[model samples]
Target: MTELSLRTRESFDAVMRKYADMVYRLAYARTGSTFDADDILQEVFLRYIRADKTYNDEEHRKAWLIRITVNCTRSFAASAYNRHRDLSEPDENAGAEDPALKAAETKSDVMKALLELPEKYRTAIYLFYYEDMSVAQIAKSLGTTETNVKTRLSRGRDMLKEKLKGVEFDV
Candidate 1:
């Protein structure tokens, strides 16, 4: 039993390492701050560790972690912490210290538009387009209906189009 538990712990750690960056990116996208993202990342993993034994299997575990991260971000967004912070200001130095960083920053305006969106729409857009998740997968991960995910995706795309009309992106 001890050996079995040890193996499970190892497996969980391996999975966390593989997907941590993606999880952090999703959190960062939602929160628009490294500090918040880091907090969410830690909370997500902590939840994973405390999860039930039924939370087995790599795919399900990954989805569960993402769902928790999203939920945590949403909760944080609604809290007083978010009320005091300004969401309009983009982090000029975030992931932008090199040439590649400069290239990525070119899309800062678009990301800002995305950040300004309602949380539901932003989550759908990020999961669908940025995270490259399918509607069904997103629905499963988010515990929503596929039709709802599709609706959100459509609305999000329309919003993005409207917001990015005058903006040109290199990529």
Candidate 2:
């Protein structure tokens, strides 16, 4: 109704449109389950909206979202419900040809190998390569040292190379 509210609404919509895919992809990369990723995406935005925090720039806002995503995924993975789930149950759609997943998995072999890496390395690699973020940016987002991020990236690349030895995928 008011000008201030209208401006806030427009900004919120813009932020959601700009970063929704990035948040979802990061969540999916972390959880390996679309359902969980969806939930994490919702949680991250909810926090963002509720925090009502101001950012210094677009990069700061992006980094904040990344940090929230990482925290939300960690919370989900550590939840009692997740811990007690039946891990033996087979993924129903594991062999299904899902078009959405097909589109997302541009280089299937590379994605598969990337998912196999440790979470620390996987997060680093995803932010660096997939999100086109610098090591310094990732360090700030993850609240870690740049040296640590570099180490993770180096180790992640090596792990992917080993896993996709016969494949034509590059890390």
Candidate 3:
């Protein structure tokens, strides 16, 4: 049993290393802030460690992670603290030297336009373009139909195109 537990721990660590970037990017895309994304990333992994459920395969695990990430970001967005907080107020903890935020700020115009979109649209676009999730897969992850996902992609594309007409980035 000890050996089995040790293997489980190793597996968890491996999953963290493998999925950390993907999870972080998803969280960042959803929250539009480095600090919020990092918080969501940590919470998602913590829940992963504590959850009683198990994943049958890599796809299952990835889907599970994405679902949890979306939930975390949504909860954060809906929280009373966030709802009452001032949007223009700077994060007291995110000092000028935060490289993660600096990197987020340096994203291209296409990325900037994507961030300007509504949360659902940003998520659909991110999952489709950056994460390479299919429309059906995104629909499953988002608890919506494939048709809804396609609609979101179409609307998001229109918004992006309008915002990025002169920008030279592939859609």
Candidate 4:
């Protein structure tokens, strides 16, 4: 990259403020480690600062950011560093309260059930219900077909339901 000055620091700070938590959560979900997720967040924003790219709209920018996050997390997961390490307890309290999911359940219960899911299934569920992405959009972000995204969501939901059975929480 040519000197790392694609945008003003102020603009980059704005982007970080808006997307940092989302990026962090995505990284955490993939790695199951807070340290690695924080590292990925820094690397993603650093790359964004150095890349010379244009976006037509906010949605496009968000899509690009999500793509970068997914790629970064995948690379992190494949690294020798990750391969040699046992995944740690998830370090963040992830998931938002869903009025549609009211129950006699705590956030930790939902988070624990979510974490018990396989990586792909957890990611699919996060993007669908939490990120509010459509199946087509998720397919595009995940570089899979819509059918595959739908299937992942279905399987993910089933897994979550099984994991959270009798917890009074709805998926």
Question: For residues 21-67, what per-residue lDDT tens digits would candidate 2 score against the true structure?
Answer: 99999998887767778799889988988887777667778889999
Error of 3 at 30 (Å): 0.8
Task: Name the weakest run of 10 consecutive residues (lDDT summed) in model 2.
Answer: 1-10
Compose the digit string of candidate 1's lDDT tens values, residues 93-153.
Answer: 5554443234335857677778767777888888877778888889988889999988887
TM-score of 2: 0.81
Candidate 4 lDDT tens digits, 1-171 = 122233435377777778898888887776555667778999999888877476666666777788898999988878876666555643233354432223313446777677668888888888888888888888888899999988888888888778778644244
Per-residue lDDT over 46-82 for candidate 3, one digit per residue giving the tens place of the 0 to 100 score: 9888873566666878898899999999899889888
TM-score-based ranking, best first?
3, 2, 4, 1
Q: Rate the local accuracy (lDDT) of all candidates.
A: 0.73, 0.81, 0.82, 0.74
Worst 10 residues of 1 by lDDT: 1-10
lDDT of 1 at 48: 70
Would you estimate the TM-scores of all the predictions?
A: 0.73, 0.81, 0.85, 0.78
TM-score of 1: 0.73
* Candidates arranged by lDDT, highest first: 3, 2, 4, 1
